[model samples]
Target: MRRWILLAALWLSAVTPACAAPPAPPQRILFVGNSLTYYGNLPATFAALAQANGHAVEAEMILEGGATLSERLADGSVQTALAGRRPQVLVLQERGGDLLCLGGRQRCEQSQHALQGLAEAARAVQARVLVLGTYQANAQASAALVEKEAAAARQAGAEYVEISQTLADLSRHQPDLPWYAEDGMHPGPALTLLDAIKLHHALYGMPEARTLEIDAPRYGANSGLQAVLRRADAAAPNAGTPPHIHYEHAQVERLVRALDHAARATDPAPATPSSAH
Candidate 1:
């Protein structure tokens, strides 16, 4: 009886499950930038893409038109967001002029300082930092500035998303897609969708695919855009393919359009002399 009991106890112990590793906490991301980020409804689009890609993400934005990183820090909005939200990721986007204008390198230094300050704050809160490489019409200047920003991110121990490079690559690969909006600064719908896709990939380590596309027939000409369309088609619940897989392409387009509206309405009003901090 004792031997049999010992055998049974051993079997029970072996069968008992080890404590499962805790599920990862839900992802929350905060985007801090000027008009470029807010205009395209980038954070919202990113959230939509993440949901479509099997990850739950919450995205919030602090957008001040033409605000530099130093200005944002001085304004204290980003600090408040970081403390209050304590997001998993903090994305920093400097204004385009600050990144590209090489007048005296003053803007560049300010940008670098801003990155460090943001990175340090994020580190304290145990959140990851992601810096967006600024993009503007002047591709040469844009590329140079992006490289510098990327270096700053690396120095600060943060990941840098090369938005400029992605745009350049897209322009080369699919020249037909409009790169910029009418203002010749902010990204258009196609570029905005691309940004969302790249952000999703950067955050989740997932490749861009057809099933993960935002709905815009205008952008459907390119292979990159087509991939997302395929994703949308594949996951359409109405198509009667898979009962569990469902994606609403219209929802994605709505988010994109809403972002565009927000961007348009908030066209950085001219700063008063006193208000130009």
Candidate 2:
């Protein structure tokens, strides 16, 4: 009897908040980004998180790589082409490859323009704005970019959610954090998990956890079936799929397979982000 009581206490401690749920909801979200964002499985991370937490989710990511927010906003390109559907949130981040443009004369100005466009879109669709500040790189490392984006969001009366820096802080120690991918352009699998963890902290009030994607389309069109764990994004709304797919016998056919491997191999998936609110 006493032994059983002690075991229950230990189990409860293990499942407590910090070791429990993160604080975000794995709900409907839309990500607007470039190649890096695509690789992170931006939408699928949330979807995966929802599954972990025993919830259903819907998320999407629009391909806009190498194009800064300013560039994407121009010509009503990204926002205009969204098919007029507004999600609960729109995540905007600078192009990872654009790190080379950091400190350039036009960086700040371009970011501002992009912020304006994002604000306009958010307003038009009644959605919130999640500014994915620049990732950690030699030239583009600074809280200013995030601050400026947040300022613009506030000015425009848009709610903001920050992630880059927090992840940076976490990455400083874990060098193998997968902050960079093989291309040296986008974040590898780790960053996506980190983003999901942070995002959970934002939307939910649960404990915290990072992820390792088990499934994905391909590392790139050619990276092959590697053991990477990034996030996955959903196709655009009302977006149709290809005519057919072949999944007969692949060593590792898709990202989902990788996730399956992870679940079978390592510890269980982190609990879903907190969904208290």
Candidate 3:
């Protein structure tokens, strides 16, 4: 009787849903941001995501921890560095902090100018430029700002990836989710990388990992974005939200339309100069 019971228990355990492990996410990305973008070894997340999905991807981070676009713009050397990489995708998360926290519409105007420069630089190098919309501790960014940022990207003919709201929603549910570090101004490197991947997947339509582990790990899922998630989860906590992670459908559709317009404007054109992260 005891032997029979043991066999039955083992069988039940094998069939339990709890026994199934969640599949790892994909990764492979290039990220740009302030210190909030670097601290947590976000690059590692991308590496892990790639490996989990049987991909071996790399990431290049061009972030000036704690410094916003204003600082980077003042320095004026990122453009040169960007030219050398000619990355597949160039992500730009402007606003060192949140717009609301800064206390001025002037900053928003400044951000617009900086974005234009970023777009030109990216276009020069023929890289896809992604505008990262930031999240806040007090609350997510205003939909107006999201629209403005997306519009700015559209005008410059660049891609748009809004991550702030997604991270904010994640924070709300996973209360302990640390969107920013102790400074409350920057995203940990790990989280930054994760955001990069998630946004890319959303924009480029990431697929599931269906490649056989034995294959050369061809492009199955989004290598660029999944790598970001892997790095964040390993280096930082990944608190994901639902559909609203970025915005309501209406806002997302707007962004999508902007991206399409940008694509059309730049289509059949040669790459432009490389810009900073």
Candidate 4:
């Protein structure tokens, strides 16, 4: 009777299907910066890119035009966002030249202090912190700024991702490409696309080739994406408005490939020793 019972159980087990594990929750990333971080709707663009690559990701941002990290910190908006969202990753971007101490010692110190405070808050939530270094039109002039930003990132116990080198390389190869808006300081649509791709790579590593074939029309139709576009359009500095370029499916694929190549060519900045912790 025992042998018959065991045989019956084994038969039932063999015929029944095994239960599958539930899918993982999406990775939550928060971007904290100014117009440079928002132009061309970078957060939405990044989310779209991750979706294309089969990654479940949620990207959000807190941005104000010409606002530095210190100002944002003082305003308490960043803190409120951090508390409410509890994102897994926090990306910090300082206004142009502030990290380089170009705005005098007082301003530079304020920026650094703000960055450290923000980093601590992120760490408290067990979130990884990343410092995104911006680029200038003049690569030679921006080199010093990039180094300063990288050093600051390390001091704050965060990882640094510098896009200046990649942008410079692209400028050399694709001179006709519009990397800057009419203002010449802010990023245009092409540059914004590049930024999104690089951020995607930084957060999730190199994407597969198949993921580069994004459906541009469908991506543009996303409500979140449209909202960002409107924000960027309204925030254009002076007469320097972004062309608001829209890519076709084929164009998007090609542009993504080119941007990916550029990103791969320029290695990411060395991570801070504490970033691994």
Candidate 5:
């Protein structure tokens, strides 16, 4: 009887599955930017992508149309937002041309100083700082801007993602894709999706983000996604709306796949350290 009981216990132990570990807490990320960051609801899109990829993430943003980093700092909204809940990551984006010195040296210096200050604040909460470089219409100008922004990010001891270079490279191969909004300045849907993927890779060090297929039907039902699409349509009602706004579920999925393929195929410019001066 004892031998039979022992044999039964061993069989049960061999067949029983081990308990699964609990999931990790969601990573909190905050974005501080203007229209470029909010036009397509980037933070929300990022959260959606993270969800699709099985990464637990909480994304939040503080934005105002045409607002610059200096303006954000002066308004104290960022500091207020950072007071209680310190996110795991903080993303900073200056005005479109501020980092390019397009507004002159003094303006650019102000922008840099504001970025450094913001970086310091993020560090106080033990958060990683990511500076997003903006794109310009001219490829040469965009490259120059990326270099300048990279230098500033290095000075601030933050990681820089040269989204300008990424967009330029992707555009060369996928010219039909809408990279810019109706204004030809702000980011369109494709660029926004690519930006989110780049940021995800920077944070998580996963190339899989570039290849994940977005579920168009599920994403289309998402309120955040719908709102952004509506905003895009509203911005250019007379222009017959961007193709993305009218894309069927299947077409949306195809577009996302194509963008992902393009991103995977292109090699973004590596971030290099630059002289702070």
Candidate 6:
């Protein structure tokens, strides 16, 4: 009877189905901010950069012109966006200065509150949060604010992408790099591309990786913009030298034109140069 029972147990074990492992979630990232994020759908560009570096990623963006984190938190847009899509990374950015934070005590407290709220939301969704350093038109004025924000972000347990320093360097090298639109306030594709590359490096720990090209189709509905981006991507620093990251003036102009046209299509107002940030 013992031998028979052992045989029956072995048979049952052999026939039973094994427990299945849950499917792995897609590597998703969500970018939340104002015009700085929206213009080029930079999150998508960043994802493309990552893909080029052999990482599969999905990126989304929440953009509103001249919006602040506090405003977004109050509007419920941030929460709604995060509910269904539990992203692996949540990127937060705002305009150059504390336009919405007001000033004095209010500015400091409100900024902290918003960051806290954002961090909490990210935590609930099991996502890491990243804060973009402030990029001002005057690079000189950026240092102090950037340092303050970087420390605050660290305190909030969020990584800070120091793109402002990168931008300042590039702008100094190529004074007319078309980093900003005619208004000078918003970023053009060239700048956005740099941001994408920088963000990719920061996220993947591959600062030296240098493939700056991405599928132009992902730039969205503007064919002119797509063509411009494709052209720019094709123009690496050196020909037959293995695609080094560099920018050309012509490529920058083409991208700026594409952005200008797109911006004009929505608002026929004449373009003006705003601050670089």
Q: Give the number of the best model, judged by TM-score.
A: 4
For each candidate, the alpha-carbon lDDT, in order, equals 0.62, 0.53, 0.50, 0.70, 0.69, 0.62
- Sorted on lDDT, best first, the list reads 4, 5, 6, 1, 2, 3
Model 1 segments beyond 4 Å from truth?
A: 1-25, 101-103, 207-277
Q: What are the root-mean-square deviations of the candidates from the true structure over C-alphas?
A: 14.1, 12.8, 16.0, 6.1, 7.4, 14.3
Between 4 and 6, whose TM-score is larger? Answer: 4
Mind giving the per-residue lDDT tens digits that candidate 4 earns over 225-244?
A: 21121222233333333334
Using lDDT as the yardstick, the better of models 4 and 5 is 4
| Model 6 error, position 117 (Å) | 0.9
**Per-residue alpha-carbon lDDT of model 5 for 142-202, expressed as tens digits?**
8898899999999999999878876887778778877777777778777777677677667
Per-residue lDDT value at 130 in model 4:
89
User: Per-residue CA lDDT of candidate 3, range 1-277, in tens?
Assistant: 9999999999998987685676643323556655445444444343443444445445655554345665555565456556765565666777544344364778766766777787788778776777766655445345545666678778768777666555554555545534565666556432444453455354443313321111111111112222121222232222331111111234233333443444446464633322223
Regions more than 4 Å wrong, model 3: 1-30, 54-56, 97-103, 139-141, 176-185, 188-194, 207-277
Residue 231 of model 1: what lDDT? 20
Q: What are the TM-scores, per candidate, against the unseen true structure?
A: 0.66, 0.60, 0.55, 0.77, 0.74, 0.65
Residue pair clashes in candidate 5: none
Q: Could you tell which candidate, 2 or 6, scores higher by TM-score? A: 6
What 10-residue stretch in candidate 4 is worst by lDDT?
220-229
Q: Where in model 2 is the C-alpha error above 4 Å? A: 1-27, 81-83, 96-103, 138-140, 206-277
The per-residue C-alpha lDDT of model 3 at residue 170 equals 50
Q: Compare candidates 3 and 4 on lDDT and give the better one.
A: 4
Which ten residues in a row are the worst by lDDT in model 1?
220-229
Span of 10 residues, lowest total lDDT, candidate 2: 243-252
Compare the candidates by lDDT and give the number of the best one: 4
Q: Model 1, range 1-277, lDDT digits (tens) per residue?
A: 9999999999998999989998766587887876676544566556667766567666666665566788877767777777887887888888775655464578777877878888898888888888877675567776786777778889878887777765675577567665676766677766666677656546664323333443312211111211010221122222322223122465345434444343346555532221000
| Winner of 1 and 3 under lDDT | 1
Clashes of each: 6, 25, 26, 0, 0, 3
